[model samples]
Target: MTIDEQQASVAVIGLGKIGLTLAAVFATNGYYIFGADKNKEVVASINQGKSHINNEPGLDQLVSDAVENNQMRATSDNVEAVAHSSIIVVIVPVLVDTANQIDYQMIDAVVEDIAKGIKKGSLVIFETTLPPGDTKNRFGKRIEERSGLRLGTDFYLAYSPERVYSNRIIEDLEKYPKVVGGINEKSLLLASTFYKQALNCQLIEVSSIETAEFSKVAECVYRDVNIALANELAQFADQTGVNISEVIVASNSQPYSHIHSPGIGVGGHCIPIYPYFFINKGLNQGLTPLAREVNDGMAAYAISQVKKEVGSLANRNVLILGLSYRENVKEPTKSTTLLLIDQLLNMNANVFVNDPLFSDREIHAFGVTPLSLQDKSISKIDIIILQAYHDDYKNLNFKDFTNCKLLFDGRNQLKQEDIKKHGITYQSIGQQSEKGEW
Candidate 1:
């Protein structure tokens, strides 16, 4: 089909934060987007113009507009989404195992389902992060075998990884440059054309889908390794009684080598896991071991710092401020915030959590009761752990936590003076403090 003659029907599988944002973007750009999810409740919520996951800003209104304009439809059945669309985008999660091994089972399952109903001439794009050969070996081959059609000639396949941050989904989607690669030139041209139509940023084309996959992994790996470096520096500084946050600020003034500031731990779905994927690949192929150790050690390091800061963990009323991996988004999947909470609870600490985005149902699932900032019962909490740095917590009054003396700022969410003025003992990774009373 000619570029302009191509139909604008796009099917987005896996309607999580990334998938829903992608579907919303395409639908806003005038594509008829059909979103499919296995969870019936998620599908029902989307159909009603409600978002079960709170990541993208103005999503309910966007989904509502899409539904009313007949540009978007959601369904629990994969067959319906696949049958209605000329392009299929897979945005599922590909998680790492306990041993830090890559698991492509979710990607394989989605590919198999899409293969059964995927049209001959439709385009297939895998936005999920995977190792080198999954796109060509696992997904492309399975679809070709199931449909009995050539990959490049009969159908198009590509990998265009999602890059938008959970905090700024809509803004980042429009601003972030997308990297796309396909098995052949025709597939590349067509996929590039499709993405350029919706996205305002530049579209970079690479040689193969593996290169595209590596590019996505490379972006995340850089962040992970840098974060690991920051974590390492923080650990070293704590031992030497040096204020590492001030060191980072002074060192970053060089302009050429700006390092990432340290936090309690690296939380979030992509950063902590993406480097592990590359590390796993390297170890399988007999490579260096430094990257894996540094990144993996960081999470434990942050938790250890929390323990050290709190002094005594036994029977302390610890209030974890944020549950989501990062700020502004309501997603706790693969978050280190929860990991720290679990560790604290295992040590028999009384953990009360609060997240503006999460519901009481989710809080109960973690065996903890949710508390609002205005809750009267939390006035006597012992420790306040600032895990995720949401906007709401940034400017919070000192009087709110007046009863609490120990504050662990995981994300450096609070100003230096604010913590000091409140007469609270505060400690954050890599950050320095002014000379004041504790």
Candidate 2:
């Protein structure tokens, strides 16, 4: 089939954050979208015009309109998705194991299911982040073996990484330039043409599938290293009574310098885990592992700083403000808040957690006592740690914590002077502490 005669039907394999957003985008662009997931509840929710994942701006209304207009539908049947669509986009997650290796089981299973119904003239594109050489070797080989078809001749295969933030997925998908690489020339042309028609954004075509795979991982590693540098500098600033935030702002004013902020630690699915995709591939890069170590150890380091200020955490009431990795998203994948809570409990501190994105049941499910922001018990807390910079807590009334002694801003979410004006001892990630009476 030629590019001019290609069908407008598209299939998205996963129904998580990225997958659902992609399905919605395609539906909005006048394509028939078949959104597939293994979870029956997720499929049912989408079919009913309700979003399973919450807190994403404008996603709910877009999904509702798609379902109402008969442009999008969700199902658990993989064969049904492949049989109906000419273009199949796989956006399933590729996770890393505890041994710092890419776990191939999830992607392998997804490919096996796709092979059952992939047609001869279809285009298969993977948007999952992967180590180099996995797409051309492992994924292409599995689909060919199952379907008994040639890759370049029978069908097209390509890899395009999903470069999007959780809260701003739709905007990023439309605004950012998309990178695509394929197994062959024909495959690259087909994938690029399809995305250009759907998204109408700038499309960058690279040489091979490995290049595209490594491009996304390389972007994450770049941020991880820069963040590790800022975090290491914050440790030094804390010991010497220096303000690291001020130094970073001044340094970034120069044209040659671009530094990220230092936080309690890096979190979310990308920054904390993407380095391991290259480290376990037998590369001789030492700085990658070192950066991971520094970022990973930041949670414990934050606990030590709290102990230094409060003398001891034994029997003290500690409240953590946010549980999700970032603000306004309900994703806790590899979040540093989990690590913070673990160490605080080990130090014999009474831990309480609160996040407006989550309910009391969800907070308690993480194995901590849940507290509402409006609860009167917050006034009696000994220390309050702000783990995420959620907008709900940004303009909070600091006077509510009447009995609180120390306020630790893990994300630098509040101003030191404003917090101190309430007569509470305020501490931040990379700021010099002022000696004053609370």
Candidate 3:
């Protein structure tokens, strides 16, 4: 029987940002998509020809077109999706607990459901960022025991880590080289061929599934280490009265010298979380752990700079712009603002936060009063912390700060002269205070 009689061309289990994008891309490639999501609202939204993720560029139109053309459909049942598709792509998240321990509960549950519904001769490709050997050692083995299926015999399993950034996933999919490795030669060959034709882009087929897993973690760890080094250099620059930003520009002119910009902290789901995977390997845990420690301490470093510049924080009106981890994105996973709020509140400082992306209720959820951009809301007095630097602050005139003493540009995105021209001292990572800078 043809695909229409029994199964779909592809099944995408998970309709989150990455998963939905993959489904839409697959649909655009002429493969009928069967999307499975536990969140009923997400499934309903997709079925109604709409995209739940609003921030991803060009996603809504893609989703609408896919659904409109009857090429894509979503369901709440994972088993139903798997049973109706010949090729299954799983792209679920593996979260970490408060103790920084990998919580495999969610992934474990999804794997079990896949094992229950995975069909004979169907290929299951995981697109999640997992620890090395999880697909082969744990998941593949478990599927064998639970489903009575033999790898490379009854079914095929492969690991292809998702390597795309938020807000640019669709573009990155076409630009970045897709990495794929499988439990065996046959699985690897199958996944590689499928991706080479489907993505119509560069493909890197590694030796083993474990290698594919390590590649993703290694990428994240390398970035974390680079960022941590920049933060350390920023600290040294502050002590030595050197401009870290200036140093980075001059140093990077060598081409071989690639120095990252220093920020308040590395606060994202990937960089901060994946370093623990590299460290937990229990081998030569050298720079990975150290980098994580340094990046995690940067939030406190920002607050320490504020304390040094303005002295007493008690009863001080401190406004924090952008509560999200970074600019433009609404995701607050492991945000630096959380750390800042804790320290500022402990110092008895009146904390006010604002992110154009987040609602007032969400801002209040952080235990800080929401600061609107209006002049009445701009009644901020003592300190202003530019945490995430959203585009809303781009044309913002500095004169709006009625009695602001210091403008701490956490990301170094703002023009220093503009703040200084308005009589407000500007401070940022790696730079001395505005008046104190050389």
Candidate 4:
């Protein structure tokens, strides 16, 4: 079948941020999209021309326009979506637990649904990040077994990792190069053709499906190790009265150095999780796991600084600023603030949380009291840790924190003298400076 024949309809099996964005982009580009998800509310919302994710730029309008134009629609039945469309794109999430093992419960169920209805000559592309060869060995085998069709012959299969940042999926899809690979030449050709025809993206075709899967993990592992190195150097800089942020800038002035900034911890869906994917593969487990250990240890280090400045943390009231992993995004997956909260609670400190993105009720779900910075009625706050540097927090008056004795700059974002000007002891990772400047 030709590319035009396959474009009769396309199935996007996962209506999450990345998946929904993919469906909208395809529909906008003049292709019919059948977006499938297990969540009935999400499907119903999409069918009503609504985008569930509010923060993603251009997604709401695109999805609305697509549904209005009869280009894309959503359903809960993956089997129906697969049977109706010739091109199937799977973006189901695969997460790792505390044991560093892949939890295939969600993705496995989606695969079972796909295998039951996947048609011959239909191209199946997995865009979820996976351990290097699991696309072929684990999921591909399952599909072949359930469908009774041979890969690279009866049907085509490919792997293309979804390399997108949350809240910027539409922009990243247009800008970043899409790395793609397949089980065979035919699979690669069809998947490449579909992408080229569907989206305005530059494609980097690789040698094999395993390479494409490995590329995404390697990209994230590089960041994880780089951040770990910065965290280690920050500790050394703290002892030697040198600011690690300045060190990072001076070292990176030359094009050769590209050091990542040290923080309270490395959080986010990609950086904190991908290293474990590599380590669990049993391929050179030395530095990767060690890096995870170093990054995760930063929360304890921050609390130790609190202990140094304000005596014991027991019975002290600690207010954490920023719950999301990153400053601006609403996502809270693997947030470092959660780690700090855990440490503070273990030290018997009463924890209060504040983030402009999350509501008071949502903050309470994390088992912490929400302290609005805008609240006029002043309350006792012993310590304030700046985990996320949201713009709304830029004008934070230390006077508001009169009872607060310490202002810990977890992201190295706050000014030191200003913090000290209010008699609040300022501290951050490796931020030992008489004159505090970046």
Candidate 5:
């Protein structure tokens, strides 16, 4: 099929952030899109023009526009989604197993389903981020053999890695450049044509599929390493009684260098996991001691800082602010704040959690009762840890926190003056509060 014909039907497997956003973008650009998910309720909600996630504006409108115009819909059956389209995109989660090894179960299952129903001359593009050589080593041959169609001629395959955040999925859809590569020239051309038509941004082509896969991993590895470095520096400055935030901001004044701010630890899915993907692959090929050591040590270091702040761990009422991975969104995947909570509980600290964006149901399942800051219930808490720097918490009065002697600013959320006036002993990332007895 040619480019125009290729634009006729597009199937997106796994209706998560990447998949759903791609579906909405393609459908709005005049392609008929089909989405599939294992969750029955999510599929039902999409089919009825609704969204299961929040803080993403205009998703409902986009879903409604697509369904009303007969451009998009959702289904629980993967076979139906595959059979209905000439271009199929697989985008499922690639999580770590119990032993911290890469688990290919979700992607393997989707490939099996697609292999059964995909047509000859069809295009299969993978948007899921995996370890390097995953397409060439794992899924590529398995898919071709199962379908009984010769790749490069009878069928096609490509890799187009996704680059967008959870909260800004829509805006980034039109902003970031899209990268495309294929098993062969034909596959690359076909996939490129499809993306160029829908996306209103730049498109770059690479030499091979593996190059594209490595590039995707490279993008994330850079972030993970830098964040780990920032966290390390933050810890060092804290020990030396120096403020790292001010240091970074001052250094950023130079036009050439721009450093990322330090945080409690790196969170979210891609940044934390992608570095391990490369490091593990490196270890299999040879030794990868440095990469493994720096990234793996980050979470534990953040937890140690929390321990330092609380002074006495036993029977302390600790209020944790921010349950999500980052501020302003409700996605909690791979949240370092949650890791801190788990470590604190192991040390026998009484924990109370709160996040403005997350629901009570989500918090209760974390084995803690959600506390309302509005009710002045913070009076009884012995320690307050600012895990997320949400906008809602920025201008909050430190006087309300006067009852709490210890304030641990995980994201550097507390101001210096407030810390001084309240006479509270405070700790923040890359920052120093006047040391006082708690």
Candidate 6:
């Protein structure tokens, strides 16, 4: 089918953050979109022109516009969505199990559903992150077997992993160059033509589907390793009385040096999780597993620092600010803040959590009492851990934390001299305390 003919309809499977955003993007670009999800509530909400995801910049108005213009519709049945469109884009998540193994069950189940209704000449593109060769080997074979059709002849198969983060989905989709690869030359040309016409972005066609799959995994692994290096350096700096942040800034004056900051721990869906997709496939050259180890231990390290400063946790009321993994995002997927809370509870500390993005009931569900920043109880807290660097907490006056004895800046958000001027013992990830005595 030609580009104009294929633009008539597009089906997006998995109506989560990425899936729903892509559906809205396609709809706004003039294609009628059919969005399918297993959640009945999400389907109903989308059909009613409401967005189920949170904290995305402009998704609500985009979805409303698409639904009002008759450019988008949603359903719970995957087969129905597939039958209504010629181009199918899959954006389901592939997660890692507790044993640090890649879990293929979710993607496998999605392919089975798509196979039941996929028509001839339809293009099936995968936007989920995968191990090196799973796209061409596992997914392609599953579609061919279930549909009783051959790839590249009766249907097309391609891989183009989603590279956008949670908060900047729409902007990144339009700004970053898209990497696309297909099982064959015809599939490549067809997929390229579709994305170029549908989105305002440049497409980089690679040699094969495996190359594209590896590219996404490689990018995430590089970040994991870089951050791990910074985390390890922070440990060394703490022991030697050196400021790791200053060292990093001075070293990065060289053109080739690009260093990431050290945090309480690595969180979010992409960096902490994507490395295992390749490591479990026997690509562990030792650096990947070690990086995961260092990043995972950072949460416990932050808790220990709190204990050191406060001297005891038996009767102290500790307030943890920010529950989400990162600033400004409402998603807590794989957030290290949860781990810190668990550790604090186990130490018998009375923990009170607060985040402007999450409701009090949401924080309470995690087995901790939620406190508002304006509550009178804030002045009575013994310690404050700034787990997330939200913009709302950036310019907070020192007067608000006067009653707090110790403040642990987990994200390095507060200045040391300013915090010290308030008479609170300040500790951060990589910087040494100015007071010398905690």
Please write out the lDDT profile of model 1 over residues 192-234, one tens digit for every residue.
9889886656988999899999888888877776777887788
How far residue 310's Cα lies from its native spot in candidate 3, in Å, is 0.9
TM-score of 3: 0.96
> After TM-score superposition, what is the CA distance of residue 11 in candidate 1 from its true location, in Å?
1.5
Q: Relative to the true structure, how large is the alpha-carbon lDDT of every model?
A: 0.79, 0.88, 0.87, 0.88, 0.79, 0.88
Tell me the lDDT of model 4 at 228: 94
Model 2 Cα displacement at 110 (Å)? 0.8
Please identify model 4 stretches exceeding 4 Å from their true place. Answer: 1-3, 433-438
RMSD of 2: 1.8
For residues 261-316, write the lDDT of model 6, one tens digit per residue.
Answer: 99898888799999998788886778988899999999899888777766778878
lDDT of 5 by residue, 316-403 (tens): 8888889988899777777767787788888888889889887788899988878888767788788887877888888877677656
Higher-TM-score candidate among 1 and 4?
4
Each candidate's clash count: 1, 0, 1, 0, 2, 0
lDDT of 4 by residue, 269-378 (tens): 78888877888878556778989999999998988877877789999989889999988888788899889888888888999888999999999999888988877533
TM-score between model 2 and native: 0.96
The C-alpha TM-scores of every prediction are 0.90, 0.96, 0.96, 0.96, 0.93, 0.95
lDDT of 2 by residue, 266-370 (tens): 888798888888888875468888999999898888888777887899999999988998777787877889988889889889999999988899989989999
Q: Candidate 1, which segments miss by more than 4 Å at Cα?
A: 1-4, 50-55, 284-292, 295-310, 400-403, 432-438
At residue 60, candidate 4 shows an lDDT of 90
TM accuracy, model 6: 0.95
Which has the greatest lDDT?
4
Which pairs clash in the backbone of model 1? 245-430
User: Across residues 1-438, which tens digit of lDDT does each residue of candidate 3 receive?
Assistant: 333443347889889999999999888877789999999999999999999996899999999999999999999998888888778899988867888888888778888888888888888899988889888888888888888989888989999999999999999999999999988888987787777655777999899999999999999989999999999999999999898999999999997998899999888789989877766767336889999889989989988888888898999998899898998888898888888999999999999997889899989988989878784857566889888978888988878787888888899889878888777878999886745344
